[model samples]
Target: MSENGAALLDEVEAFHRRFNVFPLEAAYVAVALWDAHAHLVDAFDSTPRIAFLSPEPGSGKSRALEVMETLVPNRMMAANATANAMFRAVSATETRPTILFDEVDAIFGPLAGGDEQLRAFINAGHRRGASTWRCVGDGSSQTPTEFPSFCAVAMAGLGSLPDTILTRSVIVRMRRRAPNEVIEPWRKRLNEPEGHALRDRLAKWAASVREQVDGAFPEMPEGVSDRPADVWEPLLAVADAAGGHWPARARVACVELVKAAKQSDKASIGIKLLTDLRLIFNGAERMPTAHILVSLNSLDDSPWADIGGKPLDARALAKRLGEYVTADNDPIKARNIKTGDGVVKGYYASDLHDAWTRYCPPLPESPLLPLPPLPRRSDPVDR
Candidate 1:
């Protein structure tokens, strides 16, 4: 925590605030600090993916990524990269570059037409030394070649990415700026020099403390654990090395952002389904699959109706729900229910209790003691 390092962090935050309106001031600062720490990617065991997601267009998602590209070292912006092109670009650089993929929904969305290889690459790249193998050359001389996938990745798009990617990321939910929220317009002519100056300072500072950052293990905030702790470790380490208010600021960001992600579970279809099912159950002991489907579809706002362009039927419902219930490792289990008509597949209240408790938001607290019953209103009605 040198004076120089602390001052650099402040500059980075100032630079970040100049262009974007982040929902949390800490998130904006964390993002800027991450760009500075991008140079130290190889020093850590896992590199956190920075995901900028918005519900709709015009949310400053792309602009935030653009600002990031200007600050991160050895950065590349690939808005229109094909799967092969993206792989090739990563393989082209021995020292991995900071890769920015704007409008990433096209590659991972439902209409993506099976880019599993690309998806696998991105997922594996979160950890150091992870690679993807592919066949090279003609059929007769084809040989398996390993492409290093480890890199600092930032993706900006509408909605969420797959669960795998999101779990490995520091998720930032973006929104359209309100009229009162003002930011300096980003212009290459005006901002480029300032951004470059900050980038250079960050690189110099990171180099000075590279050894300390490489082995530093900063304590994580309470409630942050496992994958999230892995993702935020490097950022927290950077903050610790930087001194100033960053260490505190970084922890605040970690706890707040992680809690927000857990509460929403926006990127996990299974978790989201579990939460919705909790509402549908309404403390029922058991529910037949048919009834569940009816209830799910009847909800005016649920995605069940549009889950693949058609209402979720019994088969689709079973398929989606099966992942959480049937898996041997899953805590929740869907059980068979015997009825007067016949034996029907369904979920028992006991089975879903664990899932609901773990995945759903806690119910609002009830009053310690029920208030006395209201006096009879018959006289008032007559009046």
Candidate 2:
């Protein structure tokens, strides 16, 4: 690594240190470098979106995006913009600006109606050569215009975004700062010059390394694959270009962040349920629904306890599992089995095994530690 490159990375780390970001240090640094190199995204096949998400307010999501706006090239800070406006803004200039979108939940949340066009634009913009066609001019003279949809985008908001957007993003889950954590307060008048100085230095470095970055393919860490790899490729390339501790740090961040995303991805709820069921099954040939519910509820970290505002009851469990099973071929079957007491409905291991292979993430060799034994109920007293 060049002395300049090492120094630049150090500066990037320092810049990130000014904030109380919840992600690991490497993630913050990677994001800093990504903002510096945002202009070169067109040279690559994919440009990953930076998504700062939190379940509730006051998690520093907006503050992080504000910091990014100061350092990225031709930054555009938008509280909200129409899809057409965004498309035109991106296509209007040869040097596309970095888009910092705040309160993204307002634009993409469940109650936000009829934003399909904007959502499509964001999704398509992740890859180069993607465009959205729109009709322009007066009714008599209208023509189809293709708008370029490639640029570095950072979005911050409450709750998770749609799966389509999240899959194309480097997700940073933020949290409120602890009482002991500290960071320098960010004030635009005081910090703008410093941020600008770093931005200029980054531009110079990026200009000198554009060709290398365009062709770069840093080896992905183990367990990173598919869309996650695509989303992280540019950040890893930037790290490789600015060598020192970065390459190692970037890999660690990639693995850890991607793992976190997978665990929290609401789209994977089915997969999670399937995997947990597999663990509950263990080596048993068959298990009753009541037994399965007990095991699931007993799990300390599983979402079963409070899924849909209620514990995982027999009906809910059957309803969820039913989505994976159909009449054609049942992967999970409920059959009446004669037990010591009477005939009862239960699931067979063979049926669940097929579901596990098809729907769940691969499990570790050892099953999750069995749920702690339920507290025994005291015998009723005569009184």
Q: Which candidate is the best by TM-score?
A: 1
Q: Highest lDDT: which candidate? A: 1
lDDT of 2 at 67: 76
List the lowest-lDDT window of 10 residues for candidate 1.
325-334
- TM-score of model 2 relative to the true fold? 0.79
**Residue by residue across 282-383, what tens digits does model 1's lDDT show?**
888899988988888888866887887898887776677666642335645456899999898888877777666765678879836888667686635433
Estimate every model's Cα lDDT from 0 to 1.
0.82, 0.81
TM-score of 1: 0.90
User: In model 1, which regions exceed 4 Å deviation?
Assistant: 1-3, 92-94, 326-336, 361-372, 377-383
Model 2 score (lDDT)? 0.81
The local distance difference test score of model 1 is 0.82
Error of 1 at 348 (Å): 2.4
Residue pairs clashing in model 1 are none
lDDT of 1 at 346: 86
